[model samples]
Each structure stands twice: as structure tokens, then as C-alpha cells.
Target: MSTVLQLVKRFREVLLDGVWIANTNFKDQLKDVTWKQAVIKAGSLNTIALLTFHIDYYIAGLIRVFEGGDLEIRDRYSFDLPPVESQEQWESLVNKLMSDAERFAVLLEQMPDTKMNEPFVAEKYGTYLRNIDGMIEHWYYHLGQITLIKKLLSSDLI
Candidate 1:
């Protein structure tokens, strides 16, 4: 495979690995927390629900654009946020995020190497290398935040 494909694959791996790590110490192991706990105010950053939503939201948005749909990345959900409120909802979200990631992985794999270096213009970030590298970087960054938040929540629990 080409270098670009390799990089894209590697980034996808990183994201999936990070997701696994985030769930490793999860109080309920992805099933334990109530909606209230998921949305509990951990810090200045958004609650786990918002963060989780953001991850899947972005992935879905980007994939849509890549597939020739027009989407605005900036306009995310607004307000007090929806209550996961139940174990079933939380688990559903987790499954959805993983499914989205898998779809993204497949999209990246199918994308041509030339597309990686092409410019993708976004309303907020402007033009960037519309490629897997940028997406991978974004994924890991948020994954790090998710991991940290999990730790913070754990400490709070104990």
C-alpha cells in the first residue's frame, strides 16, 4: 500500500485503540454509569455524554462530506444536552460511536492517496489537508481528553 493509506490505517488503529482505553477503567465498564453520571459536571470541559456525542458527530459529519454531502462542522448540538438517563442509552451511544468509527475506517481505506493531500475547507478551521492524518490527530486529541475525564470521574467516585 501507499504511504498515505498506511498512515490512514495507522490513524484508524490509534483511534480504535484509544476508544478501548477510554472504556478500560469505566466505572460501569460502559454499562455502569447512569445518565446523570455521564453528564455530571467533571470540569470546564463537557460531560462524557457531550464528549461522546461530539466524537461521533464529527466523524459522521466528516464522512458525509467525504461522501459528497455538505455539512457544517461548527454547528453542533446546543443547550443543556440530552440525558442519557439510562444504561441502555449510554451503551447505545457507545455502540454507535464504534460503528461510526468503523464506517470512517472503511471510508478512509477506500479513499485515494491523492485525496489525502487535497485541501478541505471548513468554516471554522478553514482549508486543511483533507486527509486521514488530520482526522487521526483530532481523534487522538479527544480520546486523550476522554481518558483524562474517565480518570477524573474515577477519583470522584472513590
Candidate 2:
């Protein structure tokens, strides 16, 4: 497989399953999470729901770029989650995360290897590979955080 294919494959793996370091991926970690659990603060930290939305927020931006739209996400507002006021809304958010992750990987699969080195939105942001691979890294980072939060929640340690 080409490097581009490898990057996209790695992204899916880290987001969905079989990450080398952490035992859980974003999708698996979120399994069976209730809105009440998701909204739990677990001390002063961000809620699981907030973290989930934050990770997807940037991924959605990259997905937009892949779909020929501009990247319009801002870091300041990344953690701004919609109200998970009901069970259905929580389920909807998780479903959106799954669908969006798949959509992003599919889009990346179609990109030519050469395009990976091209500017992502702008030259200042660096290459497409950097931005896309960065998303995978970002997701993995938050996956660990979510795991810890869940662990704490279950352990009654918080």
C-alpha cells in the first residue's frame, strides 16, 4: 500500500479499533455511554460528550476540505458542544461521529498520494498529510482522555 493509503488506514484504525497503545478507540470507548454519563464533569475536566464533539469538530473541518469546501473550524469554539438534552440526541451525536469518521477516511482514500504533500487549505497550515494525520493524532490523544474519564466514572474515584 502507498503511504497515502497507510495514512488513511491508520486514521480509521485509531478512530474505530486496534490502536497499538490505548486499548480502546473513540468508537468503542463511547459504546453504551448515557447522556447523564456523558455529561458528567468527573471533577473539573470536560465531559465525555464535550470531548467527543471536540474531536469530531476538527475532523468535520478536514472532511469539508476533502469535499472541496474550506476549513472553517476555530480552536476557541472547538469544545463548544451542542446540548445533549436527551437520549436520542446523545445517540445522534455518536452516530454522527461514526458516520463522519467513515466519510473522512473514504474521502482520504480518493486523494492521490501526491496531493498529500500539497497545502491544506493554505500553505501556513502545512501539507494535507500533516493536517489529516494530525487529526488522527488528535483523536488518539482525546481517546486516552475519554478512557480515563470513563475509568474514573466507573471507579467512583472522582
Candidate 3:
């Protein structure tokens, strides 16, 4: 398969549907999470809702750059999740994440293989491949945290 297609598949694996790596993707993990559960804090760890918003923040930002826009996302603002007080609000965030993830994969699949080696936005950001790989790794890191948080929330000890 082409490099771009491979990247798209890997991207989808983390955020959308594939389960080979983590045995669970964002869609599966967030499917049954209610707003209250999402917002419940596990010690000092970030809430599930905040993590969802954080990942989508980067994905949405990268999608803009892929579409020929500026890379405007900053790490400082990634976790600035608005209040998710109801099931509807939580679902909205999950829906946006899923949609942006799919869009990110689609945009990535359309990119030529040569473009992967090109700098992403600026040279400081590294190449497109690096950023994409970083995104996958980032999601997995949070996915692990979310998984543990969910487990913690479910246990009576929390």
C-alpha cells in the first residue's frame, strides 16, 4: 500500500475504528461514556471530556492546515474544554472528535507520498509524517489515560 494510505489507516486505527493496537479506539471507548462519567475527575488526571476535546483540538487544527489554512492551535489552549454538563454536550464533543478524525484521515489519504517528507506548516514543526506519527502517539497516550481513568471511575475505590 502507499505510504499516505498506510498513514490514513493508522490514523483511523487510533481515533475511529481499528482496534489492533490498543484493542480499543476512541469511538469504542467513548461510546458508552455518559456526561457525568466523562466529567468525573480521577485525582488530578484530566477528565475524559477534556481529553476528547484536547485530541480533537489538534486534529481539527491540523485539518485546517491540510486544507491550506494556518496552524493556529497552541498547546496552552488544547485542554480548554467548555463545560460538559449534559449527555447532549458530551456527545457533541465526541461527535466532533469522530468527525474531525475522519476528515483528518481523508485529507491525509489525498496527500501525495512525497508530501509526507515536506515540512508541516513550518520547519520547526517537522515533516508531515512526523506530525501525523506524533498525533497517533499522542492519542494512544491519552487513550491509555482515559482507559485507566474509566477503570478508576468504575471501581468503588475512586
Candidate 4:
């Protein structure tokens, strides 16, 4: 398989299926999680819903970039998920995340392997491969937080 395709597969594995190291994915971690559970605050940390939103927000911006659109997402606003008070809102957010993840993988798969070595945005920013891999790393980092927070919230000690 091509490098881009391989990367896309890795992305899918980490997000929706098990990967080599973690043996768990975002979808697995969120299994059976109700909307109520998603909004629960495990201590002072971010809610699961907020972290899900944050993960997708960056991918949304990266999709725009790969589509030849401008990247307008800001770090501060990335975590600014509105209150998911109702089940509908929570479901909507999750659905959006799933859709965005699929789209991102497709976009990456479509990218030529040669283009992976090109600068992503500017010389200082880094190459397409670097940014794409970094995105996966970012997702994994936040995935860890989400998993830990979920466990904390579900435990009796919480």
C-alpha cells in the first residue's frame, strides 16, 4: 500500500479501532457512553464531550487546509464546545466527529505520496507527513485524557 494509505489506516486504527500500543481506540473508549456520561466532569478536568469536540475541531481545520481552503481555527476556540445539555446535542457532536474522521482519512488517502514531503503551509510549519502524523499524536494524547477521565467519572470514588 501507499504511504498515504498506510497513514490513513493508522489514523483509522487509532480513532476507531485498536492500535499496536494502546489496544484501545476512541470509539472503544466511548463504548456505551451515554450523553449524560459524556458531560460529567471527572474532577476539574475537561468533559469527555469537550475533548471529543476538541479532537474533531483540529481535524475539521486540517480538512479545510487539504481542500485548499484557509485554516481559520484558533487554539482558544477549539475547545469552546457549547453546552451539550440534551441528548440530541450530544449525539450530534459525536456524529459530527465520526463523519469528520472519515472525511479526514479519505482526504489523506487521496493525497499523493510525493506531496507528503512538501511543506504543509510554510517552511517553518513543517511537511505534510509531519503535520499529519502530528495530528495522530495529538489525537492519541487527548484520547488518553478522555479514557482516564471516563474511568474516573465512572468509578465510585468520583
Candidate 5:
């Protein structure tokens, strides 16, 4: 398999389907989560909805760059999720995340193996491979949090 294809597989594994790392992907974790459950505050941890939005923020921003646009995302604004008050709203966010994730994978798969070593947007941001790997790691970190938060929300202790 090509390096780019391998990256796409890993990307999809975290966001959409393969479960080699967490035993759960974003699609599976967020599938049955209701708006209320997603917004439930489990201590100081971020809500599942917020984490979903946060990850999608980066994905969407990267998509723009992948499509030949500027990298306009900022860390401070990543968590600025509007609100998830209804099932429709929550589902919309999830749908967007899923679509963006697939789009990201598709864009990535189109890249040449040599492109992986090229700087992402700027030299400061490191190579395409680094950013992609960081994204996967970032998603897994939040995936663990979402999993724990779900467990806490389900337990009577929370």
C-alpha cells in the first residue's frame, strides 16, 4: 500500500470505521448519543458535542487547505461550538463531522507519496505527514475522553 493510502486508512479508522486503536470510532461512539447526553456536563471535561465540533473544526480547516485554500484555523476557536440543543442540531454536527472526515481522507488519498514530506501550509506547521499524524493522535486523545465521559454520564456517580 502507498504511504498516502495508509494515512487515509488511519484517518478513517479514527473518525469513521476501523477500530484497531480505540476499539471505537467517532461514528460508532456518537451514533446513539442524544443531544442531551452529548451536552451533559461530566465535571470540567468538555462535552462530547464540543469535542466532536472541535475535531471537525480542524478537519474542515484542513480540507480548505487541501483544496488550495489558506489554513485559517486557530486553536482558540476550535472549541467554539455554537450549541447542540436539539436532535436535529446534534445530528447535523455529527453528519458534518462524518462528511468532513471522509472528504479529508479522499483529499489525502489523492496526494502523492512525495507530498507527505512537503510542508503542510507553512514550514512552521511541519510536513503533511506530521499534521495528519497529529490529527489522528488528537482524535484518539479526545476519543478516550469521550469514552470516559460517556461512561461517567451513564454511571449514577455522575
Candidate 6:
């Protein structure tokens, strides 16, 4: 495979693997705690559930933008975070996230290698590759936050 294709494959693997493991770890920790406990304020902002939604939100938005679609997250603070009231709600969001990621993954894989290095203009970010590089960094950063939050939430359970 070409370098871009290989990079795309590696990117897909990173996304899928991180989501799979993080979701599993979070859900497992969540099982022993009530919604209130899960949403307990560990700090000023971002509950475990909110962090999870934030994770999916950015990944989906970035992938959509990379696919030459209109920007998804126009206003960073425009959206409300998901409420951690029930496991069912959390599970629903998680499922939607997985579905979104899978769709984006397929789209990325179908893209021509030449497209990866091509320039696309964005209002906020000038070039496409720059945005994609930022996307990868952003996703992994949130993955770290999710892992930390899961551990914090897991404390009460254990």
C-alpha cells in the first residue's frame, strides 16, 4: 500500500481500537455505579458521560470535514453535553458514536491516496492535511481524558 493509504489504515485502526477499548472499559466501570455517580463532578467541567460524547462529537465532525463535507462543529460551545441519567441513554449515544465512526472509517478507506495530501480550504483551518493532523491529535487527546475519567469513575466502583 502507498504511504497515504497505509496512514489511512493506521488512522482507522487507531480510531476503532481506541473506541472499542475505551467504551468497553467505561461501560464496565459504569455498570457498578448509578448515573449520578457516573456524572459526579470530578472537576469544574466535563463529567465522564460528557467526555464520552465529546469524544464522538469531535471525531465524527473531523471525519466529516475531511470527507469534503460542510463543517459540523461550527460553534464549539453551541452544543449541550449528554446527560448521564441512565445507562440506556449512554449506551444509545455510544452506539451512535460507533456507527458514526464506522461510517467515517469506510469513507476514509474509500478515498484515493492522492486525496489525502490534497489541499482543501476551511474557514478555520487553512489546509486539509493540517486539519487531519489536528484531528488525529485531538482524538487521541480525548482518548486519554476518557481513560482518566474512566479510572476516576472506576474508583467508586472498586
lDDT tens digits by residue: candidate 3, 1-158: 98888889988998888889999999999999999999999889999999999999999999999999999999999999988889999999999999999898889989999999999989999999999988899899999999999999999978
Q: Please tell me which model should have the higher lDDT, number 4 or number 5.
A: 5
Q: How does candidate 5 fare on TM-score? A: 0.98
Task: Estimate the overall C-alpha local distance difference test score of candidate 3.
Answer: 0.92
From the highest lDDT down, the ranking of the candidates is 5, 3, 4, 2, 1, 6
**For each candidate, what TM-score against the reference?**
0.73, 0.95, 0.98, 0.94, 0.98, 0.72
Candidate 1 global CA lDDT score: 0.64
Clashes of 3: 0
lDDT of 2 by residue, 1-158 (tens): 98789997788887876667676688888987998999999888889999989988888888887898988999999988878898888888888888898898888899899998899888899998888788778778888888889989899587
Reference-based lDDT, each prediction: 0.64, 0.86, 0.92, 0.87, 0.93, 0.61
Q: Candidate 2 local accuracy as lDDT?
A: 0.86
Return the lDDT, model 3, position 88. 94
Q: After the best TM-score superposition of candidate 1, give how far the Cα of residue 88 lies from its true spot, in angstroms.
A: 1.4
For residue 85, give model 2's deviation from the true position in Å: 1.2
TM-score of 6: 0.72
lDDT of 5 by residue, 1-158 (tens): 99899999999999899889999999999998999999998888999999999999999999999999999999999999997789999999999999999999999999999999999989999999999988899899999999899899889978
Candidate 6, residues 49-141: lDDT per residue as tens digits? 676677677667767776777765754742467456776776676676667767766776776767666665544565555666666666666
Worst 10 residues of 4 by lDDT: 14-23
Off by over 4 Å in 2: none
Candidate with the greatest lDDT versus the true structure: 5
Q: Write the per-residue lDDT of candidate 1 for residues 29-145, one digit (tens) a residue.
A: 334555666777775877777777777777788788878888756644522346777777887887887778778778777767666555675545543344456666665676666
